[model samples]
Structure formats: structure tokens, C-alpha cells
Target: MQTEYDVIIVGGGLAGLTLAGLLGHQGLECVVIEAGEKIDRVDSVPDDPRALAITHASRNILASFHAWQCLPQDRLACFRGMQVWDENGSGAIAFDSTELGRPTLGYIVEQAVLQTSLEQAVRSLSGISVLHNSRPCDIQWQDDHVSVILDKGENISAHLLVAADGVQSACRAMAGINYRVHDYRQRAVVCVTRTALPHGEIARQRFLTDGPLAFLPMYPDHQCGIVWSTRPAHAEALLKMTEREFNQALQAAFEHTLGEVKESERRSCFPLRRAEAEYYCRERFALIGDAAHSVHPLAGQGANLGLLDAASLAQLILEAGVKGRDIGGRRVLRSYERWRKGENRIVMMTMEGFKYVFENQSSPVPMLRNRALNFANSFIPLKHTIMRYAMGLSGDLPVAAK
Candidate 1:
């Protein structure tokens, strides 16, 4: 029951745990406080219908913490290519790993699998601890450190307090940080399905009139993870449909790209929104993962962005420690903010732009977008550039991500 550490991470999710592992391995003492049951034991992770798209860069960061290695090979699927097309018109674009001189474009993994592996990796590190079923009730900001008061009457002090909590981050609110959320007016219906035809290890996205539908390949050739973003009313209707009806609707929406889609797992839904904090850090406080920002699932970049935030912040903190400087100092934390804020904002805007262009059914706009897609597809240089950027292979990336 150590009361003090170099860093106290709020939220033992992927981002927080990843930070703990990175810092602990570099000789920094860290503790992760989570308001959930302890999940460090083997097979303790719960089931989740949500799937995450892990870019090559994100994989590198996880590999640095050795979490990627802990993942079961059978639970992971590599998508060697992606096919995107618009259902409104005859326009489509495709990206392949061969074009980028890579073996695979990225990976599709269950959210629970990723979190479990990351938590296990963090737990194995020497100077890191996880305190589950613990909630932070208050924060005492100091000149060089921060003290967190837990609901269970525990006081934990650290040089830095990083909020890796989810979208409604209580830590961010408690720290007086303001955030902006833009509701997409849609809900993403997620589930795992088995298709009549094999997925061919490729990911597919179709832009419908209302929103986008993505079929991400999962383990086993015929299985895929489905993210169908649509209006609330439509989403509710889909949820209420019979299994057979839902399968037919899904198959029709996807245009049978992989043949009939059978509901192989329970379905779930969540609202889609783009949220960002006004500032990334204040004094000894900082935000990471969904705590700082949440993007549309259209591009499947939320988890990847959060993982990058963790890596970037950890790198900066380790750099400050090596120089004998206060890792929680305003200067060090601001550096992390400056490094990721704009980059994340760009991605958010990109997602918004994609949403607007497709959702706009106005005359000429649809035709123009279709033309744009085709034009981009035929242009090798532009296509490669988009592939690199989307896959996170090109950017001012963190050391671990690179």
C-alpha cells in the first residue's frame, strides 16, 4: 500500500496501463487507480462486443510494452487490405499492404482482449501497481506533485496524475478541465458475425446514405466484426429485429460483400461523438485516451489515437526524468499537449469531413465525392499518401510508435 509514486494513472484501461508499463520499465514508480473490479487474474477480462482497429504504429507501441506479444494469436486478425465504396454511387477505393511495402495494413482485435493483454503486461512490470475498485474523490494540486483522495479514505501522492478514464472522465472534470463534444446524431451498432463467404483477410467499409458500415475481419476466415453507424431511430429498429431479419438487413446494408452475415455474437450499440478537451494538461494533471478526446468510429481511429497519446506522454515524462527535471512541471506536460493536441484535432476534423461529404446528398456534392474517390484511387502517389497517414505510418510519431 504505497502512498506515493512518480505517477498516479487514473483509469486502468489500455492507455493508462500502457503508460504504467512504459514508465515502470524505465525505473519510474507508477500506480493505476481503476473504479472497477480487479482484472489482473487470468481469464478475468469480461466479454465486449466492441472491436478496435489497431494501426501498425499502435502495434509498435504495444510491442514496446510487450503487451502485443501477450495477445493470443487466435484472437487477433490481420487485415492485409481495405476496400471502401459508396453505396449511393459507383465510386470506390482500395488500399493494400503491398502498395506500402508492408506485410499487413493493420490488425482487428476485440477490445477486451487488448485491455486484458495490456493490463497483464503492466502488472508484470516491477515498479507498477494496479488498484482496482478504487475511485478518486478529490485532487490536491501542489507546486511539484498532486495528491488524489480516494473514496475508500486512501491518499495517494504522485509527481503527475494522468487521467486515462473514458469519455465522461471524472478526473478531467474534477481537475476543472473543459471538454467539447459533438454528437454525430447516430449510434454505432456493433457485433461479431459469421459470413457465408470468407473475408479474405480484408476490411471493408460502405458509405450508406445515413452513415457508414464497416466489416472488419476477425479470427477464422468467415468471421467479421461489424460496426454499423446509423441514425438513432434506425439503430433502435435494427436492434429490435429478429436474428434472421437482422442478418438479412446486415447483408443488404453490406451489399453481401462477404455473402450472408449471420449474427454469431450478441449485438450492442453506443452513440458516436467527437469530443476534445480544451487543453490536454494543467500543472500536474494530464489527460489521455478517451479522457482527452473521442473520435467517430467511421475511421476506427479512437483507440489508436489514445494509444499514441499514452506513448507520447510517457516519452516526454521519461525524457524529463532523465534530465533531472520535474516530470510534472508545466513545461513538460505542455510539451505533451503541444505534441498531440493538433495531431488529434486533425484526425477529428478529417473524420468530420468524411462524414459531411458522404452524408451530404445535395446535388453535385455526391457526384463530386464519388469522382474524388475514383480520382484518388487512380492516383498512385495520392493513394499511397492517404494509406500511410490513415495507417499511422507517416507522421511525427512518438519514439515507441515509430
Candidate 2:
């Protein structure tokens, strides 16, 4: 029996494509099965309505793949500072990159930009191929390898299989992985807002009794990516508002931090939920990105966490190959699982803790949180440590990120 590939990654997304690029760079044969043809050319995807906070480690990984260079130089905005506060109390804390001896904290970017870059890099690299307009209908796991059956009757077999199919992953479902989903009873309303004032290269978030509202800077303009998480009923009402009316509400939400939300794209909303798979991997299989876990978007660490998942899994697989061991072996996959799962869990829980603190702004907690924020702000070392973690520079990261 001949193994067709070293890996067959389902869902040609940020995690899968990045993993393919890394493994391909190492001379491993890999195939990425994508659901749509247009996904292969993500540059054509409109740059509208959404953005991500790319961490420093994620940038390094992209740079190693030569994908970072593909992003438009002018379309990148680097934020040097972050300010987070409570709407009901004086619990305010600010972080500056200068304190951490770094020029910037993170880059704000559009997902389309990253998708195009990763797909392009994967295509250029040797030993990796993407099957566009292809979707896997079934997965057959054997003692030695796994075979993916495509809807088009195509068969792809590999020593290892990875699921990067997203939060509601079909692959995860096939694997019988139990997902714990907690509904926040909230919806995240997002849009591109043309602010009256310049963003000044800062990321700002204000936590209200309902939820958190974020203003992330965008490139080459005074535009901000606004992500407002609130109750579903409130989100419905907000979504029903006229553009002018919505911008007015947006201005009120931020309390005129950027003056007025003068112009904005058609706003959209998605239900908020926290989900985690029972395990990150099983024999001959692994999960990455949203397939493995999803954190609250309030922290803006979702994709950053996914990139690290890709890097760490690839690192472990490559190491297993070097030792002449089965890369898809349970032990090899466990090592990757243990590392990524733990980190993702810790981050998710921390976000939950923060969310709870913000959502329950009763009386005593508000005063306590205010004091905690002031204390954290006044204490330079503690603030630097927190900022460092947010920058993705504080842990045992893969070589690609380093």
C-alpha cells in the first residue's frame, strides 16, 4: 500500500493552508481540499466589513512562508497602543508597545488579504496541491493512513489528516468529536466605520453592561473596524437602523472616542457562542483553527490562536518524521494536542473571566475591578507582561513564529 500523501488537510482555510505551506516547505507531500473554487483566489474576495488583529508571532510565521510579503504594504495598519475600559465604572487600563520595548503591538488586517497570501504561498511551494471546488464527503481511517472521499468521487489518502473546517466543522462531526458550545445570548455586530477623527493607530474597546465594543484601525484611511457584541434583541434593533442612525448609535457606543462614526458599511451580525472540541486530535487525525476551539472575539485572538495551532502541529509532525516514527501516530499527535489544547483552553478561560467581569458590573465588583485596573495600569511590569501575551511573544512558540 502506497501512501498518496504525508497529509491531506480538509478545509483550505487559514489553518490548513498555512499548515500545508509549512509542511510543503519541509518537502512533505500534502493536498488541501477546498469547498469552493473562489477560495483559491481569495484576492477576488471583497475587502469589506471585517478585520483581524494579527499578532507578532503570526507575522513571523507568515514571513517565513513568504506570505507576509504578499500583503499590500499600504493596506497594513500597526497599532502601538490599546485602551480598554468599563462604561459603568472607572476600570480603565491602557497598554503601550513602548513599555514592552517594541515598536508596535499588532497589525490590523482584512481576512481576505491573509487568505490570498496564504493560498498564493501554498500554491508556489513544492509538494503541496490544493483541490479547489472540492469537498470531502466522507473520511475512512485505517490502521496506517486515512482516506478522504470527495463528493466528486475522488479519493485522497495520506498518512495524516487534519480538520481546519471551522467552528461547525463537518470533519469534526465525522470524527464524533463532542463540542461544548455555550451560547452567550449575544450577537457580534460588525462594520467598517469612517470615523470623524483619526484612529491614531490605536485599538480601543469599551465594555458596557451588554457587551464589548471594539474600534480597530485600518490601513491608509481614518476608517475603523467596529465589532460590537451585544444582546441578540439589541443587535436586531441595531441592525434594523438606517446607516445614519446606526452610525449615531456607534458614536454613542464609543462615547465619541473617534468623534463621530460618520460613514459605515452595511452592518451585519453573527450569533456569539463559545465552543471547544473534546480533544484536539486522535490517531491519524488532528484539528486546528476554529475546528479545535473558538474564543470570544472580544479579545481578537481567534486567528492568532489558529496560526499557532498550525505552526505547533506542523513542528511536531516534522519532528516525528525526522525520528523515523509515524507522524500520524497517536503519541506524535498527542504531543501536539497537549501543547495547543492547553494554551487554547487557558486563553479561552481568561477571555471568559474577563467577559464575566465586564458583563456583571453590579456594585462591589465594579469598584474592585476599577481598583484592579488602576493597579494594573500603575504597575508597569504587570502591564508589560499582559501586553506581551497579547502580542503572542510570551510562550513556547514554534520555530516558524520565532
Best by TM-score, which number?
A: 1
- Positional deviation of 79 in candidate 2, in angstroms? 0.5
Q: Model 2: per-residue lDDT, tens digit, 119-205?
A: 888899879888888888999999999998889887879999999989889999999898899999999998888988898999999
Count: clashes, candidate 1: 0
Which digits, one per residue and each the tens of the lDDT, describe model 1 over residues 1-402? Answer: 899999999998888888898898788999999998876543666867887889989999999878899998988999999999998899999999998789899999999988888888888898998998998999999887899999999999999999999999999999899999988899999999999999998999999999999999999999999999999999999899888999999999998888887665788999998899999999999999999999999888999999899999999999998899999998888899999998898898888899999999999999999999999999999999899988998878999999
Off by over 4 Å in 2: 1-3, 39-43, 46-48
User: Pick by lDDT: which candidate is best?
Assistant: 1
Task: State every prediction's TM-score relative to the real structure.
Answer: 0.98, 0.97
Report how far off residue 103 is in candidate 1 (Å): 0.8
- Clash number for each model: 0, 0
